[model samples]
Target chain A: MRIWDPSIETLDRVSLRQLQLTRLRETIDRAYHHVPCYRSKFDELGLGPGDFRNLEDLRRFPFTTKEDLRLNYPYGMFAVPMKEVVRIHSSSGTTGKPTVVGYTKKDLESWAQLVSRFMTAAGVTDEDIVHIAFGYGLFTGAFGLHYGAERIGASVIPMSSGNTDKQIMIMQDYRSSALVCTPSYALTIADRMEKTGIDPATLALKVGLFGAEPWSEEMRRELETRLGIVATDNYGLSEIMGPGVAGDCLERCGMHIAEDHFIAEIIDPETLESLPFGEWGELVLTTISKEALPMIRYRTRDITRLHPEPCRCGRTHVRMEKTRGRSDDMLIIKGVNVFPTQVEEILFQAEGCEPHYQLIVDRQDNVDSLTVEVEVNDQIFFDEMKLQRIFIQQLEKKLATGLGVGVRVKLVEPSSIPRFEGKATRVIDRRSR
Target chain B: MKVEQISIFIENKSGRLAEVSRVLGEAKVNIRALSLADTSDFGILRLIVDRTDEARKVLQAHNFTVNKTEVVAVEVPDRPAGLAEILQILDDVQINVEYMYAFVERCSGNAVIIFRFDNVDEAIAALLGRGVNVLKGEQVYEL
Candidate 1:
């Protein structure tokens, strides 16, 4: 019922900008001096850390992209030495190399504090038992929420992901108070609970924090009803400190960004210039307070607008619209992000598959399903039915493993799918909004 | 001998079949026999036409996916077991039929069954060796 850091969270725009200015100056200096990539980019533009004057100066610098992070690979973007770095996390990439993120000990502390602020804002109390169901290991979602809940003196349940029946059992036995994971997985747990005929009112869950992929308001309504809890969407990306970058504050309005640490801007994706507030455009973030791997003007490719108006909750941070669509070809299926080009890369490299393929995405029974219809060469088409079935199954397995989501592949004869005259229509999303 | 058949992939829409008919009619292509294999999303319009090359070209020019497949054209008498005997011979020989369609010419008592086999060469050889009459490409097209 209390804001974690009231002084910083509710700071007026004048002081917040003053604080951000100091942090941005330090971040820019750290990046230019330590990270070779940042240094070279600045050198190419004939700019330096000293050139940064005010918030508007961010537009003058070139944008950092996912490709740049990948090009740097494991640690090229880190501004601190490995000895000072405490942790590393990565996101799945279309190409073989992934986008790696590093955190110094101070960076970790700040990240945990930011995450704690959002959790508290979402109405999770210290006395509550928080159950973190996001996947562990390489992904940042699970660990970020885990440490934040622990930081706030809440008892944490590190029940990674999967094992639905056991998840339901823990919810009953442990009397978990707050549920944390992707919205889709929360729905999956609700679905399993329904099959087992367990009434959600019998559980102790009161609040849910969901993120890591785009979800719908309708999904929020269903999750709230199914779990008997107030479900709030949290927005974040691995490029910018994971799930605590911004989150809703029990208002069920737009998610409030941790603006003191991360300055956000909405830009026209084509023009790459800042759009007027409240107009939908691609989201770009500049991490002012991040130290180890400080990212300046990182293009997130997520489409949402900023709402700087005063919120009913009294928080001064800007609220971003819940992102339901992205500016890129990224598709969020069952909480996993997939790109059509990624599917193209996998299918094009696999044998017996023609480069021609179409991605059909639909939601059935409240779960997102991806159906990839691919064209097969003449040799496979004429093969026995059993052989064709086997091939399709194998292709489905390969794609599912690559995409980190279940895939259903249907084989069509060569040239059966329509060819577009210009820009090929590779994806058809039939999922009703 | 082998007979060439034109197969066009059609979306399962209301006017798709009519569109195909109009395209072939405009090209002056005579349809000897026709059948449809369909699924929920799409269908394959299989046609044995008087001009196989012209039909395939016209459909392809109209942006339709068209393919030429070789099938066997056999004479089945109008008697009850006439079609059964031909299928029985193939069943006995283990020649799996992928798909088949039939049509009769000019109110003739004999029907020509078009059979698509997995092993087309072996099936043709076995049918010919058994004294079954199989029409050549020209004979079927000229009929």
Candidate 2:
């Protein structure tokens, strides 16, 4: 169990770029000769190892997407033999097909080191007990953190998502020191804690590493205040390792990218061209240390910006603001593009509706109509006429203010809607003509 | 002794019921007796139709959350003491009725009452053994 402090993490901007260039050269050379997928792609573009002498030439490679991973399917993109692969993780595949990721023994160690580095950055020590609440089995969130916690020499709880009551019980009984899960689940835990008459502030949790879904600053403020713990954001995709790519320090300003193991790029999602510092665009990543499967310029589809300025915490790695939104996850209601997070923010702020909501989109007379079914708590009694009217009016006003479009809000009873244990299915698009 | 009943879970919203009706109507399926068991958020629309399979297909094609169950329909004379006789038999058997609805039998001087009981078979046997007329699936479909 070892930890890298913020002051001694690794590589300044100059040395970091140099290290990437060296790794890029070796990686390209290996891929060109070994992997048939990369060999044909490189040959088609008339590119060679010499062409990738620096970061600029790395652009000569084509960008990989989630669609590409799916197109290749099971083992099409493996750069190494099957015997060399040791572990596999996959995306949730809620949108379409699941993207499969494989790793070798060495790859696992590298992933563990990077994740341990992230935990250490968030102040996790060997004496801490980490309660990992992310879903395990095929999903990278759980196992990625599991190995990392073991590497950091922390006692792992492996709570593996859902059963909020059991999670809280273990947190109280075991005196857990840290929590790892999606931010939504963390809020749910806090909500359940209140209902169970337990104060979250009295829990043994000192820090939380929340990610795997796009969350807003308002959500962070709510979670931190409710849970009374230092909540930090961890960013990763199964396409490029797992939950160890970058993490936030105590500064809470932005997540620090592990530039030593991976290269981070921001490009205009539509134009596919690079954006300057502080400019919002799509995030692209290239894994230099991954062996079983290495991706070059993979479009992450997450909307965020890169801050090149060094943080006051003394970590020299580049910092990125928490993801604002995902380009693909945006739902077009009528003519306006609406984000689920925007609706969530309004629901949290509104005095009417509970946090549970579902967006129903259907086509009527060749025009799309968005209906938001909001679950109201005990505050709105169905038998009370006055309360019902007030609830509807409050919800409609709040939704219009938050989304900038007129929305129809249907008040429903609490717990009447379906609850998701993993990624929430918020939007249902039924527009078949 | 046996009756086919279709129950569909529907989220309470404008035009949802209309949409379900439209699907069934387009399929030329006639609904005999229908009742909605509702809460504030969602409702279960229970129906006895002329063509249960066709009605279910239509509803499912329209993406309605529909399910099928077995119920009992008893035939009673359209006169005083007709329903009382049926209730006396059910009470003797200690069979509780969760919900019940009525439909007049076409061209017959009798009313067909659909009963969703805690125990459908026991209720059917009790009414039949007591010499009470119980409608079969074909009889209910014909009605």
TM-score of each candidate? 0.79, 0.66
Give lDDT per model, in order.
Answer: 0.85, 0.79
Q: Which candidate achieves the best lDDT against the true structure?
A: 1
DockQ of candidates 1 onward, in order? Answer: 0.09, 0.06
Query: Where does the lowest 10-residue lDDT sum fall in candidate 2 chain A?
Result: A378-387
In candidate 1 the C-alpha lDDT for residue A264 amounts to 91
lDDT (tens digit, per residue) of candidate 2 on A1-433: 2237543364577877888888878777776777777777788898877786569887778787766776778778888998999998776332334568899999999999888988988889889999999777777889989999899899999888778899999999999989998776787788889998999878899989888766678778887898898898999888899889999878878898888778888999888888888999999998887889988788888889999787877778888898876767666443234667777767776644448889987755334577888765433333223335666778787776566457888765445579888988888878541
Shift in Å, residue A95, candidate 1: 6.8
Score candidate 1 by DockQ.
0.09
CAPRI docking class of candidate 2: incorrect
Error of 1 at B79 (Å): 8.2
